[model samples]
Target: MITRKRGAYTGRNKSSAYKDLVWTVATTKDTTLPLETQIQETLQIIDDNLKELHSNKHQIVSAQVYLANIKDKPVMDEIWKKWIGDNPDHWPQRACLGVDLEGDVLIEISVTAVADL
Candidate 1:
């Protein structure tokens, strides 16, 4: 029953935040790359954060993906499916939406996962 917080922010200061068994992460894609590459890059960021929390994709309980354009869903989905692999049982509940992300970021992802004990 440990609580950890990563990327916490207070008046311009930032750090990671976690609580109990769950860890959370939020990231945006590098718009300089193609949509597919952005998806890959975003997923990599998620993977890295999960690793830091002693978890992996399999432990993700839920996720929210934001796209600059809703039409990009299909392509993003394709990359997401590949990144998560073929294990349906390991999949998390997810949602995607169109948003106005900051900078040149075309995609953004936020995830919540259970940490490994």
Candidate 2:
């Protein structure tokens, strides 16, 4: 089994490592945006990171989403459904929770997926 990591950085240092699969955790940078937009952007980031690992939404095994406000769950759900598309079999096990996010970040998403390789 192989593993990969991306966007893993601390302070001013950076690293580039690739393996069989990748697990990524990302948060929205713009909390001022509407919940829907934030969710959409977060999903886009997930998609991009998965692509780097030769994977996609279909390969996702699990996902965790953090929200600044629980009231926005419905809105986030709508966007999440559309983002994952129509493949029910490809949907990952997911959970959402309310949390105190830093800065303007209104939403955060983390996912684990298998690589096509």
Candidate 3:
């Protein structure tokens, strides 16, 4: 069976889980925030979502990050590294890309993790 968390839109749920794996994505609701704040907020949302799905950052297997500006990757990378912590084992395989996002949104992140259950 699949577990799903509803999203703001009808066409899609925020995240879904099946068996051992849970997938989720997040963006800051307030786009006016600075890039660093946006990344921090989005990651916090991801943290919450992961816990709701019975997992944590350490369980994340992979991640995909989208940025409105490729030029900001250095900034994004710095924050991401801090968030992932110093444990090498906890770092997930991650890829980031510069993409045109909707509205003032500057950053978005998607993650997949294995649930403890």
**Candidate number achieving the greatest lDDT relative to the actual structure:** 3
lDDT of 2: 0.77
Estimated TM-score per prediction? 0.82, 0.83, 0.98
* Model 2 worst lDDT run, 10 consecutive residues: 8-17
- Model 1 alpha-carbon drift over 4 Å, by segment: 1-20
Q: How would you encode candidate 1's per-residue C-alpha lDDT over 6-34 as one tens digit per residue?
A: 45345431114355345555554446888
Candidate 1, 22: how far from true, in Å?
3.1
Give one digit per residue, the lDDT tens place, for model 2 in 43-74: 88888878876888888888889998978889
Better of 2 and 3 by lDDT: 3
TM-score-sorted candidate list, best first? 3, 2, 1
* RMSD over all Cα atoms, model 3: 0.6
Residue 73, candidate 2: C-alpha displacement in angstroms: 0.7
Per-model tally of clashing residue pairs: 11, 2, 0
What is each predicted model's overall lDDT from 0 to 1?
0.76, 0.77, 0.95
lDDT (C-alpha) at residue 52 in model 2: 70
